[model samples]
Target: MRLERTRREPEAGMAVRTQLPAPPAWMRWLPALFVAALLLVEPFTPVDWPVSFALITVPLLAAFTQGPLGVAAVTVFAVLFEGVLAGTPCCAGRSVGYLWERHYVASYVCTILVGAIGTVLAAHRTRRERTLADVRFVAEIAQRVLLRPVPHRIGNLLLESLYLSAAAEARIGGDLYEAVPTSYGVRLLIGDVRGKGLLAVETAATLLGAFREAAHDEPDLPSLADRVEVSMGRRAMLLGGGEVGERFVTAVFAEIPTEGHLVRIVNCGHPPPLLIRSDEVSELDRGRSAPPLNLGVLVGEPYSVDVYDFRPGDQLLLYTDGITETRDPHGVFYPLLERLRSWGPLPPRELLEQLHGDLMAYSHNGLQDDIAALTACLLADQPAEPAPPSDGAGGSSGAP
Candidate 1:
């Protein structure tokens, strides 16, 4: 007769809490110290079963609280303690022969085996931990090098820039801004690439690479924009896409002339940049509407750039739609125009910081997308000349 067997449910493992419970510093050290003490007493006295059992606690504690480093250290402490406590002098008439050959050989082997396993386990754990740390370090380096910190000054333009990448897990969606002085004027670009991750980064890089080159040669913003579109189209062909099929980049380029009072602003399906004055803020509206760069379906001519009157003491704030499109829980969007209205009279950097802080506080420190802000404030007047060429002399410019 065959007997029926019953199936049993597997026991659930303990759930790791998001918040790590940090034990007291002294208390954390206690178990390892205790193991060290036992190892010290292990060999001098007759080998006790209790002592080997006690060794288990050190590693278990280290494994939980101190991690791999602590485990390895505890193992070393055990080895040294064992060597000092138990190893006999291999000298004639000093019990060396008896101790080495007969009296404690089996016990010594058993004691060593347990400690050796702990040490090896600890070492393996340490190596694995180090590998993880190295991976994280490399990722952080890539992010730093890829998204370099844009200096506060680009060519003749005094820039105050702010960039905030969403949480690390989000992999940073593409929101890009750059200011470079060309033969034409101080050319500034603010763009948000279609989609995210590697694809978005590739599109952003392609657009900027083309812009930087074209901005110097194209002279007109439309030509530069066309160049960007062509470059983006080429990349989409090479990379193939889900986002490229459904998404497109919105961009705005500004060319600020040193001698002129007017600044050319090109809005290529991009959100209009806000102009902040002493009392009010207004969007730099476009006269001719156009599609975003790299729609691919239709290749169009260059759109005309709008000229804006920017007097001294005026500030231009350029940003991606992330700032304006951020929705609160109540379906209310953050109004950049209104915020700038109340938060004007602030210097460029300070104003951007204030906006950043308010956004964070309002969103409970959670951002769903990348944010890039570029503020250029026109100074009332050029103040004074530098003493000489000491370093990169910039003691005379910027707005108050």
Candidate 2:
């Protein structure tokens, strides 16, 4: 079944912002102006000094900041200037045929050789940049499809999410999350695959696909979890290639009822969700847990849903192990609960912003794994504002 009435963040294709402003207009022609100045000074310079050598700088600079055509233009200007100097009475004091003089001939030949090399280098640089741009486009499309943006509001809940991949080159990793509104309630899933790279990404996509489809049809949290587990088993068999037995996912699947102050959770070997109220932070459940999904064969017992009191004004925090396991130079793990005490009940968006900055600082920007965090806050007594219109991207959806 298709998700209904979902709004997602719009994709921005290839728009990159820079901290530095564009160079001033005068800078564009500075190289040509400098070459002209050198040509003018050649006549006045001491006979021992060859000012024509300075003209080489024009083509070298143009190669880095301009295309091959610009470099060729500079090279042509240098050649014409040399010819003028050879024929000028005040300069070389010889006719245009002085271009055949041994010294003048050597200078002209060296200039052409340098310009030719610069042109080839400029062409190669341009091709490499275009290739990188194409790769970035593909990565962005994949990211938008796999980890769709969570809306700012879903039903009566205000939501905020953050995702960071440790591999700076690849903006996507195995961490995953999805929140869908369903006839039963609003169902959510936050998970991390067993490993990294393409295999981990494949497993993550499979789990989310299963959760999105089964979330609405299943009557309860446990049934939904079972359906996902079955789906994962099939994927593991098809993709795992003898390592199927080793694949698994650590996740927390939850349900927030449409008109109640209760939130049910089933932790499948993932970190427990945190409950944050004004100046208070508590772990939702530490009593029991199910095996990581796809490894249900190892656990004889069935998964159990732990129900918690989710009063209005309280925020529920779900995350992958990347947060708790982040270590400092001293090898001590991050103190997540201690830090939350100081945040003082901020809105979901602000809370995540503060947490991400603090986490990066604590780890000294050396995160070793992918991190994904989702915060959901139940609205206060006042009625929630209607959700903004969808960008028509069709993100996951459910019932009010």
RMSD of 1: 15.1
- Estimate, for each residue in 46-149, the C-alpha lDDT of model 2 and write its tens digit: 65565766776677777766678878887877766676665465663332345556887777777788889878877876776666666655665687788887
lDDT per prediction? 0.67, 0.81
Supply candidate 1's per-residue lDDT for 128.
66
Candidate 1 stretches with Cα past 4 Å from truth are 1-65, 72-136, 139-146, 169-172, 241-244, 296-301, 329-331, 383-400
lDDT of 1 by residue, 1-400 (tens): 1111111113322222223335689777787678667656545554333254455445555654555556667655654444443454422123432334333455445545655565566566666656655654554444444444455665445577777766443323488887777778788889998777777777777777888778888968877877777888777778775655555788988888877766888888888888877877888995575678877348455677899998887888899987887777776788778777776578877887788888776666666678888888776656688666443455544547
Question: Ten residues in a row with the worst lDDT in model 1?
Answer: 1-10
